[model samples]
Target: MNDTVKRKLNIALRINWFCYVGLLLLFVVRNLLLEGGSIQLWVIQTVPLLLVLPGLIKQRYRSYLWLCFILLLYITTSVVGVMMPTRGWEDGVMVALSLILFFSAMMSSRWHRMQ
Candidate 1:
């Protein structure tokens, strides 16, 4: 890859990581505050994401691809949360973060393949 592509790839990867971690933290805190610290909820929400962590850390293109697929579940739920009568700001944040994560992961995977 050229320098520009390399730089863009790095930026995309960083954004991917940021959104990934942010979503994870959001779920954890939301569970703690709203769900009374439900362990089952945390595991259900986080384990799939955690499963792809090693691939993400290794900059594997397939991992980014898988992350995008996993993010769809979150996106769907967050959208539903946003539409609910009792929604909070966190629900909006979750939608935004998951969307960003999805696009950035797609970009990262594409760039990684090019490299």
Candidate 2:
């Protein structure tokens, strides 16, 4: 296989393991540790939705773009976290940040193949 194809495959494999596997574990942790079966859990679940959004789009996503997206979300979450004390909205934001972090780490490839 060409280097480009091989690189893409490797990255995709890594993404599957890291994001899916790690996120699943975190979901369990949130349920076990935090307010289980409550709104908190619900918020945590929505996090994955944002993480997977880039995949649904037609354009090929590079690691830099992914990182930028995650960082933007992270920054938004952090700001919201500090400003909003209420557990209702902010907790969801926190979950979102966690999701971004995990997803970014997972999807990131050593060599990004942009199309």
Candidate 3:
């Protein structure tokens, strides 16, 4: 890839990681702090991302593509949460952040494959 694309991909990759990790942490912390949630519940919230983290850390295009698929699940969940009567601003924030992660992951993977 050209320098510009490479830089863009790197930036996107970083943003994807930030959003994914931040959301994961937020889920865990929010549940534990607010609800005294169980570790099992936290694991359930986090295990999906654990499956993809290694590949993502390695900057694999295939991983990025798969992550886009994974992000769809989160996006759907966030939208549903936002629509629910009990949902908060946090749910809306998650929806926005996940969309950013999805876009960044898609673009990063596409750019990586193009190179």
Tens digit per residue, CA lDDT, model 1, 81-110: 999999888999999999999999999999
Name every residue pair that clashes in candidate 1.
none
Candidate topping TM-score: 1
Q: After superposition, how far is residue 30 of candidate 2 from its true place, in Å?
A: 1.4
How would you encode candidate 2's per-residue C-alpha lDDT over 16-99 as one tens digit per residue?
445444544555565665664555654665474456556624334454356445545545664675566554644564556555
Report the Cα lDDT for residue 105, model 3: 88
Error of 2 at 31 (Å): 3.0
State the lDDT at 89 in candidate 2: 46
Candidate 2 TM-score, true structure as reference: 0.39
Alpha-carbon RMSD of each model: 1.1, 6.8, 1.4
Model 2 residue runs over 4 Å out of place are 1-5, 8-12, 32-37, 48-59, 62-68, 71-115
lDDT of 1: 0.93
Distance from true position, residue 108, model 1, in Å?
A: 0.3
The TM-score values for the models, in the order shown, are 0.95, 0.39, 0.90
The lDDT leader among the candidates is: 1
How far residue 52's Cα lies from its native spot in candidate 2, in Å, is: 2.2
